[model samples]
Target: MSKFILNKILPLFFLAFILLCFNCDGRDSIKKNHTQVLEENNLIQEFSEQVTYIPETNLETVTDTLLSSGYKIHIKTYFNMDSSVLKTRHQDSLNLKSYYRNGLADVIISTDDNVLFSKTITKTFIRENLSKPIEGLKSFILKSIWIDENTALNGTVIAIQMEYCIPETQDCLTFKLSVKTSGEYQLKQL
Candidate 1:
């Protein structure tokens, strides 16, 4: 009888206990998940409080259009969504997508009569003006743009702000690009 109890009953008891643990949703796993979510929310609030507030251009988040002295200047920035390499490539190769997404813009300046200047600006545009290269920047974006119309002070009619950011993080560097009415531009760290 003792042997039977040890052989059959003990195994059944152990099996029941294991199933109970697996079925319990009110366990430590749920507690840990809840704790992690709370921590993430706190971190988000902290990041916002520490960072300088910058306004976002609601117009496509990448498009800016302004009219100055009868010259219509249009700026558009886009990410290369056609590339499937981000999905197919390994983790180490994912950084390549950053180049396609960030640091490229189509700048067009035209008037009611004809197109004056049309060019695609690339990463070299930023690197040439920067004293030192920005390291570990996963992506960048044209955060906002506005017509200053104050060419008398700095020969810049339009002022643009661009942000360089780490992937999925709050770390970033902001740059100010001053653009003249004649379609020429200059960049400086801000």
Candidate 2:
């Protein structure tokens, strides 16, 4: 009787161990499959579609509404004093040139590497002889008033403020311009 009982218990224990091992393996496989499914579906790509570009016509309406809502659009452009070439450090200043001149800037809108709509703004700029142009200029600064996301179009509407300054003159120019960028802009993500 004792021998027979020992035999039964040993087989039961061995069977239980094998079953647990198989169960754990099955769970791991399920987890892997779930991960693969998620990767295939790619949440980032899905989220990209939800973001839409504001049409050019809509942008005008939006800008008008924003202007009426007491939102002042300020842009500053820093030139090389004489040349339209942008300063390396102040490259962002040129984003609104079209807007300041025509009240709009043409922008390429993309969603997750997908190009949506390309449009321009109506911001315009007029610069006089603010300073003498310099040659072989090294660097400059362009700063503009901050505009929130809602007031501007879906893309980035950068306000250019400063022009590149030469080492000798240390003078720069500012122009008010608006740049319109759409679809997956860094500002939109933030």
Candidate 3:
């Protein structure tokens, strides 16, 4: 009678232990799924905050017009659905020159793993020595007059020119910069 009772009680105890393990496993799986979802949401929120939302403009007409005007383009950067600079590959480059004179910031479109595209940027400091300011120039503004996206079938390109200037002294300096969009938007020392 004692042997029969022991056999029955041991089996019942083993069954209960197995059920508890299954329950614990199910709960752990749910917890893991919940944690993954939270992480994704946080990433999305961070991306939204860093990116500027711009509707995709038709580059067809703009390309034809630029081409007919005898202008050639070689796009240096490519645009994508992900417009967040924080999540882009060029985050380090973007953060480096994000700010300029008078508290101006950059608008970048990263292309490759280490490439960035900025529509316009101001030249305030001397390139030879960033600590020193440009002589007689309070601000040298460079603008993107036209973007020729169709120039490269497989890729996109842009042409940015520095046609404007703001001189601090009476003497005026006139210069223009025309370079295709590429790796990093860096201004050559003038």
State TM-scores per candidate. 0.43, 0.19, 0.25
Off by over 4 Å in 1: 1-64, 82-103, 111-117, 138-156
Over 41-135, each residue of candidate 3 has an lDDT whose tens digit, in order, gives 67534433343332243121122222442334332322223321221224522322121122122334443343344442434422342344456
The backbone clash count of each candidate, in order, is 0, 28, 3
lDDT (Cα, tens digit) per residue for candidate 1, span 1-190: 9999999999999999999988886565565654366566685334222221121222233454545356666777654333211112224312222222333567666668776557665455677777777764334443333344454235335565566654445766777666666666677777
User: Is candidate 1 or 3 superior in TM-score?
Assistant: 1
TM-score attained by model 2: 0.19
Better of 1 and 3 by lDDT: 1
Model 1 TM-score (2 dp): 0.43
User: Which ranges in model 2 have alpha carbons more than 4 Å from their true place?
Assistant: 1-5, 26-190
Instruction: Pick the lDDT winner.
Output: 1
lDDT of 2: 0.35
Ranking of candidates on lDDT, top first: 1, 3, 2
Top candidate when judged by TM-score against the true structure: 1
Tens digit of per-residue lDDT, candidate 2, span 1-190: 8898789988898999999887876554565654365566685334322321112132222321133322334332222223233222213212221111112333333334444334332112122222333343234323222344453544344332223333234565444334344322221101
